[model samples]
Target: MSKLDIKQLTKQIIDGVGGEENIVSAAHCSTRLRIVLKDDSLIETDIVAEIDGVKGSFNNGGQFQIILGTGLVNQVYQEFLVQTDLSEVGKEELKEIASSKLNIAQRILKALADVFVPILPALVASGLLMGLNNLLTAEGLFVSGETVIGAYPQFADLAEMINIFANTAFVFLPILIGFYAAKIFGGTPVLGAVIGAIMIHPDLLNGYSYGQAVLDNTVPVWNVFGFEIAKVGYQGTVLPVIGAAFVLAKTEKVLRKFIPMMLDNIITPLLAVLFTASFTFIAIGPVMRVVGDWMTNGVMWLFFELGPIGGAIYGVVYPLLVITGMHHSLVTSEMQILANIETLGGSPTFAVVAASNVAQGAAALAVFYLFKKDVKMKAIASAAGISALLGITEPAVFGVNLKLKYPFVAALIGSAAGAAYATWREVLSVSQGPAGLPGVIVIRPQSMVQYMVALGIAFVVTFVVTILFAKMSQGKSKLN
Candidate 1:
């Protein structure tokens, strides 16, 4: 068999899928090409799946997806953008760049975006309701004696449920991430989730003390093979579990291949579980917890040194982080900040970040209005924009902003402006929450008002800019 050049194979795969002409818009989930087609009738699903580098093809939830393994999916998507004429109007000059000084940073930012996309909606809805709960509770609406309308009574229980669901994701998110990591590593998700569950177990939590001394003047008290171990918590974490699961999966695979067939099924699983669990508890978790703590300390250093400016910078950078999936790296830091501060009361940049999402959504809406003739693009734009307004930016950013050239620029502009205002005002949040407009209410009410004003200005700026740019660049070429 001839060895296939992956680059050439990827190009061929895209060409086979209606040659970009049949593609309406293209985005990605974790491991699949979530493509919208100009005409589904033109797609030859079987033939596409048969292509050299293609994994599989399927249609679900009104999306025609082509599955490709992790790293290759984005490469294939880029190939489509470069080889085809799907470039949005006015942004043709920015297409097909092979290298740049900021390439590393850009890649990192894109990773952050991807990691947060799947969890955005749930985070937003919960954060929004959480903020509302605070507002209603403070205003004597929920527990007040004087009330003509029973809106408070009807919503109180529902609000509590939403709050629990939203916070639960952050509290136990490691388990969910571990499941996905396991799948990525070709291991059983259940096994990985069990590892995460162990890390967060009550016994483990009760055993670790934050300020306990592990060493006295360089002489270690706690030691594993003469190495001092740092005591730390692993709840709501990411890297440690993922790294451990990968090792476990590889070990499982190796054991299955080498062990005698008679003992493989029972003995392999038992060994895999025992070894992996022991390694995690005795080694990986402690090491990773130290690393996570160091990272939190670094972020805190910046926060204290730069104050609101640091937050504004974080806000401006966060969306790009979301794009690349590196945002997972920040989760430990954010959670630590919450644990330390107990409230977002000292920093206002959270509100700015939330506002930027609204701006991105507004930009999408602008694209929809400007591209009236392209009904499919219009619908996608509308859906994405509306979703963003409601605090879900995955559909807007991945489905629309990045695809439509002007929208991303609009979002950037809005984010920068909003961040600047947030920094200037010194607005502070009362709690940590999702990145969206409704989540802005987590800030002190007075600060939230200022944040809302900043967001309003950002929305207008982004909307106007996107509309003007879209109209100015109209008729250059359609997305299809």
Candidate 2:
């Protein structure tokens, strides 16, 4: 059977939906087609849902979503941009469309950037090296005697220094998040980082370590009320710093707007710093800690009750949380769990999630291979799959699987299989690892072989299943 010309099919699909006239805005994520319209009333979503290549269509967060699987979504997006009037929409209109009260994409995008942008460079460097390192270490190229070369006295010194700077962002994520949060809220990011630094100061951490309590001793410095507060280090934390930064940014903005210039310059910084720090120490930190504890305990209870199945279910839900931008809320909880409990056994859900990401990448690759006759589709699929494999799933999900019709199902099935296997095998991840190749190390060193095998099986299952399904349906003609 001849393959559907992806570009032509995309054009037809767009034209059927009233062309560029109907579209107000459009974007793609790892697995879905995100679109806003001038008037959804003018388009027939049910009709679009029944299109030859479209998997499904639904309205979410005020955007009309067309599920396109993984590999083909980018092709469709590109074709739409070329063949439709959406390309003609002015920048002001695009911004207005994006900022329309009903749209949440901007905020979601910002949050995603906040979490991912800072880590990207380090992630890329470390991820590629980590993969190569695994291969080298496995071949005994980096081994010294029975111990790894990293354990050698000469190598250990340099390795520790590199590891420190490379891993510091993750270790002190709260400070990074505080800076970004301040930027998001229209505040001085540098100031917010300084504030975050103070919260995580070594001296304060030492005080907390010594079991010191808040003492009611006021020491005024620069007209700001200073009281010795109980300290809880914010390094690698998520909630307290973010919460503090959010309040501080708003306070600073309001002060800048209303307070007289002379007083504003001096008084605003003092009040903002003092108030934000005080609130963080006295209220936000404790509350967030309690909340984090509760979440960890709740997940732990579920793990105890449902065992591996619960872990599998969590694996499935975690990605969906990432899609909705709600995953940030759980970062603090996961860190707290790591702090209180040495291992993530009680929360082994990410093992399956890691598999899911790999599965999605595989499914995308399958589509790329299947639609070889369509050069544009093939190119987009390859790029999307590679991106997914590297832990950047937006392009894969928004660009490929959702567009290909059957790949999303394949990804889900693959994830379920991986989750089930990991749960049954009691696979555990110790650290909060990347969702891609580096995550392979999350498995216990002794069980690394089993982890790789399980991951391979999941990817193969998803890829083969999706390719076969797509092949079987090739001869049949369907309408958009």
Candidate 3:
């Protein structure tokens, strides 16, 4: 929209949402303008729906949201802020306001999302490279039942290098986590990296090999002034680094407050890192490690042990979690699953996610056909469908499915059926990636075909069911 048009729309939005007074805070994510309101009852959602540029709107997890779709939400959000005199509200302050209403669980999840979102590109790139490396190293797929490297001896060095490059992210995951987690928890990013490095330093016994070392009766420990503390490195752990960073950030902030300005510069950082490191190595790291292990084991048991039933249940609830915005929190769990890939066999959670994503996309695609005459809706559904198929589903869910109601239910049924098949066949991923068609790049070579079939089931089931539901809604009357 033009400058004047945006300004006009912004004014209309301000008026529609009970003016600036009703809004506690406002922010925007990929495609939605999210606002926390003092009174939800005062929200003029009908008026919001009538506003130009608003594709849809809803209230979820204390945030009243208006779906503006991609490429435009930011524009509207910026203008909304100017009109509401909230131009000075920065990201951190806005987050503080937005998080005030969230429960403990929600806040924790949101923190994970904040830390992981910035580093997602790194994870995605590494996952894709890992998948390529897997195909190159795996046997019985291409070239006379031997691995690609075996068939072509000339490429052996190249294959090894690819493997190294692919595994780098997972091996040094704590460092990345520490840096981002520190940023999230309000600590120095570089200091976080130093602490992260300390956890995986060569002087320490590798955490990955600690289990084996225990079996061999060779677990190493440091005599810390009479205390026997394990000198174990947290190679691929998530929670330990996160906890350590939180402590580091809080400790550094406290030191900065009490220390004199002259000596504070040198002493504060040094003491903060030293104290945080000592405490982490002594307590936080080990304790959090056990907690992390339990959480991983529980999820592993559900997907790998309970089989199809577990997968079906998770599939049904995945969309609900998305609605509540808690699904973003799963990034950390996905990391843990990938870290233990050798023991867990592979990552089934990713495969199930792929099924759920495909079903949502397929359902939205059906809506595009169902509302062919409504140009605005058709556009939203078309774009949302494609985006969901590419592993982003918020637009599809909020803009297309929930608006009509039946499409959401269709997606759930389809997702459940597809996820069951994935679990039954034990489909697995070699690395983490997108949750739809692109995710196939990361699936284990042996499970690739089966993974595709699972998504196909989701697409077909959701598409067919959405159509049937729309048609059955009324004999002579049209669906809203």
Could you tell which candidate, 2 or 3, scores higher by TM-score? 3
Best by lDDT: 3
The TM-score, computed over Cα atoms with residue i paired to residue i, of candidate 2 is 0.66
lDDT per model vs. reference? 0.62, 0.63, 0.85
Give me the candidate number with maximum TM-score.
3
User: In what order do the candidates fall by lDDT, top score first?
Assistant: 3, 2, 1
What's model 3's TM-score?
0.90
User: For model 1, what is the alpha-carbon lDDT of residue 317?
Assistant: 81
Give a tens-digit lDDT track for model 2, residues 4-82.
4877667666765667777767777655667777776776655674566675455534466666767777777766776
Q: For model 3, how does the per-residue alpha-carbon lDDT over 372-417 read when each residue is reduced to its tens digit?
A: 7888888878888998999988778877798789999999999999
- Judge candidate 3 at residue 284 and give its lDDT: 97
Query: Deviation in angstroms for 270 in model 3?
Result: 2.4
Candidate 3 global Cα RMSD: 2.9
Off by over 4 Å in 1: 1-180, 201-208, 212-233, 298-304, 319-353, 364-384, 391-407, 420-451, 464-480
Q: Can you give the lDDT of residue 213 in candidate 3?
A: 93
